[model samples]
Target: MTGERDNNGVVGVGADLDSLFAEVEALRELASDSDKARDSARVYDFGIRWGALLSGRLQRLAHYHHRGELTPHEQARYEKLRTELRDVQPLAERLGIARPTIPLEDRR
Candidate 1:
């Protein structure tokens, strides 16, 4: 039950982020179209004037294992994100995200 899919196998926010990545690629291709390049230019000039935000912010179903340890900052962020997750875990569950009942460290 703890994965990118729920007990019912619904895909989660990862899929949504993947779709967003695809949309970004399509937008780039559209910008290269000479005939409608002006139309694309307006959107692109505004949109990518700033770089796109990576989907790295999501913590759902994420593991912080880097050689089996977390840095102090990452541990802090993990604790904070874990606390924040309690608020939205229900909704996140609908999208196929879950946290284990036991802490990962304890589990090992």
Candidate 2:
């Protein structure tokens, strides 16, 4: 039962991340359109929403990491999340969106 539950959780996380990636790609396309003014309200709205979503995801990953002593697999998963968050931070900054601050403990 525990194994099933863990697999379900992993699947859910993968689905959520996939959805978020699609949203981010859509936002990127919108931002890159020649007709769209960068300073337009629509752009800012999307940027803000994307930033919030990314921030929430990072926080959840951090919470998961700190939940208990992680097995090797869990540690690897957490590292991947951290790397992804780092990769996205600069894009958020470029969009004039506030980037999430990853906790110092998670830096390791």
Candidate 3:
């Protein structure tokens, strides 16, 4: 089912981001010519795209949350999304990827 696959995709994105983080940490000591270093760069790129998609979803969640129509549980879900946005925002910049802009209260 589409919903099932979407859930898998979300999990996959998180996995990729974790792998990228591991690669980045490994890169700190490895030289550029090393195999691990090369693989890390590739994985890091993949992570960036995944992060962008995830970021977009988080932004939409924030938008809906600010609309003030959701239930308490839904509001909590959006707050979690905001937390995710904050986490990935720095990673995007460190990876040299364009950061996603989440429209918040000041913009409305």
Candidate 4:
């Protein structure tokens, strides 16, 4: 939040901008935990590592959607994440936050 902002002040309008940053950081921490857990068991692999990365990114994107300020890329990513999370109900419960729905305008 310490850069040259555009005419809008920040990059763009975010409904819950403050919480967005905090959630993203928490997601990163979760990813780090996933990585460490795998590495500790000598089960670390490219795919698993990438999964952790994707998980973290999805969480951050969800935060953006919750704030009503997702970009085009984040919007596309959100759809995939929502589907994946839906399939893993237990994981979703652990997250304690709902996945984001695509805005009407972004729907096919």
Model 3: per-residue Cα lDDT over 1-108, one tens digit each: 111224222223344344434534433334333464356676476566556554654444444445554456555544554555455555545545545466423343
Ranking by lDDT: 2, 3, 4, 1
Clashing pairs in 4: none
Question: How well does candidate 1 match the true structure in TM-score terms?
Answer: 0.28
The digit string of per-residue lDDT tens for model 4 on 1-108 reads 132345543243232233333444444444447654345333234334434444554444555566655565545545554554444434323433333333323345
Tell me how candidate 4 scores on lDDT. Answer: 0.43
The C-alpha stretches of model 2 lying farther than 4 A from their native spots are 1-7, 27-39, 68-78, 103-106
Clashes of 1: 0
Clashing residue pairs in candidate 3 are none
Clashing pairs in 2: none
Ten contiguous residues with the weakest lDDT in model 2: 1-10
Which residue pairs overlap in candidate 1's backbone?
Answer: none
Candidate achieving higher TM-score, 1 or 2: 2
For each candidate, what is the lDDT?
Answer: 0.40, 0.58, 0.47, 0.43
- True-structure RMSD for candidate 4: 10.3
Compared with the true structure, model 4 gives a TM-score of 0.32
Candidate topping TM-score:
2
Which lDDT tens digits does candidate 2 get at residues 1-108? Answer: 111236434334454455555655665576567556366686688777777766776455555556643455655666765566566555556667666576533533
The TM-score between candidate 3 and the true structure equals 0.44
RMSD of 1: 14.8
